[model samples]
Target: MTECDDTHGCDTISRRAALTGALAILASATARPALAQTYPTRVMQLIVPFAAGGGVDVVVRVVAEAAGDILKQRLVIENRGGAGTVLGSQAVAKAEPDGYTLLAAPTTMVINPALRSSLPFDWKTDLVPVAMIAKLPFVVTSGLKLPAKTMKELEALGKTRGTPITFGSGGANTVAHLAGEVFGLVSGAPVLHVAYRGEAPALTDSMSGNIDVMFSTLAGASAHVKAGTLRALGVTTAKRTSLLPDVPTVAEQGYAGYDLSAWVALVAPKNTPPAVVATLNAAVNGALAKPEIAARLIEIGAEPAPDTTAALASFMAKDAQTWAGVIKAAGIKGE
Candidate 1:
């Protein structure tokens, strides 16, 4: 063999490497569509960051069940409630970026980051919003025995009470807790927060007169309000909800812009394929469009709020900002 010059051999190797890389890229581009098209070969896990039987869990189960039918695959619900939603949320954040693992969380997903200085994962960076399922306005409810029957009366009573008026929350830094803090800020009342394990316990305490006030989801407090166990002062929405049509909103009740509600949405670990996100978003919206699913959600005091991925992402960003301001103003701390 003739002696090979160094330049010629190196140039040939580089060209071959470049060609191989080009072919590999082309193959990957071709495979992505196929993978997205044939996704969900296995069951999908929808992790609810709250306990079963709570408002979020109940609503998600209904929507997930419907969406599962539309996607023609099982969407299994796994409740991982603890640490004010941090436990379950962290699980999803650390899970593989594959579409198989999903998070079905409430507003707490956004609120936690604002209230806590240190979190296991950064929600804004690690979790990608897939779809918004529903939103439920909070009903400012009081124990039946409380002297206040209206928001104004509650504020007056809270100001005059020898001890700070106690408000029950599902947990520290939860939406309910933040709502109560907002109410206190707007009304200039001295309020004490009582944290519970979940909404069920908070509602139970409210009904038993153990707590003076609770900003509870319409679903969690409606039955008690209707049964005369809890009194509805005002709803935490800009307008009255159809489920509680007779109740006035906090905005209309002299608190001109007091709108706070709990919302549920689906999110996945960052880097989940865009095609998978699109597939899930389409399935969620399709399920929300079904009259049966809509009716059931409304019956439980939730409004179907299916939206595009970009819209949900923007909404969550704004929501987080709003809550961050509120938390900072109120000096709220996380558990």
Candidate 2:
């Protein structure tokens, strides 16, 4: 036999080679659990792309606690807020695909691509959807100083004000900011967009009567509305939120099609095993089904909708199409 064949020959193999093969097999057998089955042998990190108090972070913490129950391990949340969630998203995208690293992303997941031409990571391709947790309807609220009580009245007042009404938003390219822009487009109202560091700063300015109006997730403005600091004119969603059931939707108020809501979802790095994704997704769905979880989400003006990866993907694509057109038409250049 040729030397090459002999080297790999079954019968010609040396006792030393046999011993080496046996040791390699033994090592693999011992390492299998650490590499696979022992997944999350420690705490898994879920990176929230926004500040701690935001809607996305709030919902994630709720889901994390519930999911943790099933996993029997702590699901730690890390807040990496900045650059409109890009920083956190990029960090998760580059993380190892061992399912230990996850991302708590917002509806901005789809909108960011349309806003910025060059992103650090490909959101659609790099992030694998684990669960679509819930959606927080955008509230069209104004400072208590604004006289308008309804969307139509707000439009008329905008005309009477003459100058484009300036509105405070969480940040540029955020869902609330984009929703305000869309509202302006549909209502034919002149609104000059103003970006803020976060909802708190924006609401503070709104409460101070410095800003005329603001678009925010219901959770951010719910307490302010209860305290009479801000006036809720209408929600920017198809259906009225349970938290603000008395308030009409923008569509019901005047605009025919003014539904815009921001969502929170869980995702892992691309290439994560499907089984792992399903396990996490199932946990989230189960958590949302809990009465306590649903009740808490309702209190925040959010609707619980634990959906599959396919459903999340389809919704994201639709959101991307809708907002991409709006962003492009409005010429929203990113920072």
TM-score of each: 0.87, 0.84
Name the lDDT of candidate 2.
Answer: 0.82
Query: lDDT by residue for model 2 over 53-80, one digit each (tens)?
Result: 7666677788789888877788999988
Find the candidate with the highest TM-score and give its number: 1
Candidate 1 per-residue lDDT over residues 91-148, each given as its tens digit: 9999998999999968988888766778999989999999999997788888878999
Q: List the residue pairs that clash in candidate 2.
A: none
Candidate 1 lowest-lDDT run of ten: 1-10
lDDT of 2 at 229: 79
The runs of at least 3 residues in candidate 2 whose Cα sits more than 4 Å from the true structure, single-residue gaps closed, are 1-37, 328-335
Q: CA shift at 136, candidate 1, in angstroms?
A: 2.1
